[model samples]
Target: MDAINLVSARELARRNGLSFPNESPEYRQARDELLAEEIELRRHIERVAEQRRALPPGGQVRKDYRFQGPDGEVTLRDLFADKSTLVIYSYMYGPQRERPCPMCTSMLSAFDGEVPDICQQVAFAVVARSPIERLLAFKKERGWHHLPLYSDTTDEFSRDYHAIGPDGGDGAAYNVFTIKDGVIRHFWNPEMGFATADPGQDPRGAPDFMPLWTVLDTTPDGRPPSWYPSLTYGSGP
Candidate 1:
């Protein structure tokens, strides 16, 4: 919908009948104002997505990057399976680290449950610089069954995709590729990182992908400042 033709978000919010038990007039007024902003935010998100979808054709893939999956070595095109669109998430789980990045693991844990639904629309693959066997073992340990894990055995894909730093350290990456008329091409990937982060906030892409953060954002005390996800949390339900 065009912004100029639509009613103002404040007017729409003011017309809402939602009310909570024992909520004071002050609370309702403040909430209605916040609701107006939320409506505007939703419109902004839709606008951004529409612009992204309208982008011109991206760069074509030249190199035949290979990865090792449970079955055997597979080319980047093979990762697409039956879908024309593909999404690859390179988690920070290189061989140098004794354990996978807890943050990545946390994100994947949430993704695991949605893989089936996500794959219905586009192919999704989880990649790491670690060996296939190592990745499989960790996947089993985490009880993740749906994530299609692959190993960037040669680091060629990782290097080209900016998942590997100049110092050889691993970094998290999320890339989208599309195949049209049997030609694979790069689609989109978030460029925001440490260099683009705002003051007092961590570097993160727009439309945050992590459900953990999204959930915490709804609480009064949002995500903790110093706290981070761990491989294991000591004794909990």
Candidate 2:
């Protein structure tokens, strides 16, 4: 049996919580099953992460663009920070959009403090179409001192990677790459709940990386479809 058998999404949502659909009995049942599945899923995530680390760093992605740094402007090639593996998190900040992506921000909240340890092994950075000045200002506003933000304002790197939604539109993503012989290649790119929807089971496993799942653990009901409001500006979950 699932861990949360006594509650329903409707009941969960009643008290400032958003969860399974109130009209669908099946959605509620599936939501309950997800609780136990999530536990086993976390172990699976550990294995997949191990697999990602085992992949002898495939492909060579070579593209050049300019970026803004703490000191001044820099180039895309400089983003490697001398590491073999470069992880690029496509931030949702864009020219048309006014606010940073609440989801991306939540995923990053954990990494913000652990970046020092991560930088020692694998290099990571955040890329966005937003101007360097604008991105930096928001970083300050959010107190994100650990991340290295970059701009792809002049190049099609974001489009090439499908990081953005449309031409001059908006989207966000998590893309990883490997550089070899002055060329970089795509390795892994994971999207929210996308792996589970795959047919080949290539997604392999699941985890509570999504904030909704974590919040659901505490309540009898699960999470809501409503936007994930920012915790950076607000208090508590």
Candidate 3:
């Protein structure tokens, strides 16, 4: 048989209706397109990121919502960790939920060391509507200390950013903002546009954080149309 190299086993698996073992000419061609697709996707994603960067300053934030730190009495501005750009991932550990969202916990688990790396460049944090003690308890339970954690217990900040919707619903979102010259301006954020609503919340889109694709590159099976687990203190879970 003629030798063919493929770019991605996943694509090869997709194109051939079965898994492609090792790189073949067919695999190579598929891999090339896969590479091209990645670049295109990167550019496409970056275009959206640029849109976030381009948002005009809305003005100074009207409210100074409170959050808790080890010390206490911190405001929204304080959460920035002294970076001009601040990213807050409003987490789903709310007063009503029985547990912190596993997926959100998974994404946040990556932020451990990533916090310091980005903190050197930008401020980053995770906030939840749950009380400070409850949020911290979950933080401890999850072993997530690499990133700064806060509690938007009062509901002011989440409400202003549209991070939280109707009451009796899940709370939290991925929102990025800027504070300059003492004014707060919205920047970027993510949402479940079409994720199916669990019970009470509006129908939202599926949670899409791409880890599966990156992980599957290693062995025979690769990622099976799934998300990848996060890095661990040792090996991943």
On lDDT, the stronger of 1 and 2 is: 1
Ranking by TM-score: 1, 3, 2
Better of 1 and 3 by lDDT: 1
TM-score of each: 0.98, 0.67, 0.71
151, model 2: CA deviation in Å? 1.6
C-alpha lDDT score of every prediction, in listed order: 0.94, 0.69, 0.67
- Comparing candidate 2 with candidate 3, which one achieves the higher lDDT? 2
RMSD of 3: 8.2
- Tens digit of per-residue lDDT, candidate 1, span 172-228: 999999999999999999988999999988888998998899999999999888888
Give the per-residue Cα lDDT of candidate 1 at 169. 100
Residue-level lDDT of model 2, residues 86-170, one tens digit each, is 7887778777778777877777766677789989988888888888899888878778779877887764877877776646676
Q: Which ten residues in a row have the lowest lDDT in candidate 3?
A: 1-10
- For model 1 the local lDDT of residue 140 reads 91
- What is the lDDT, from 0 to 100, of the residue 139 in candidate 2? 76
Error of 3 at 168 (Å): 2.3
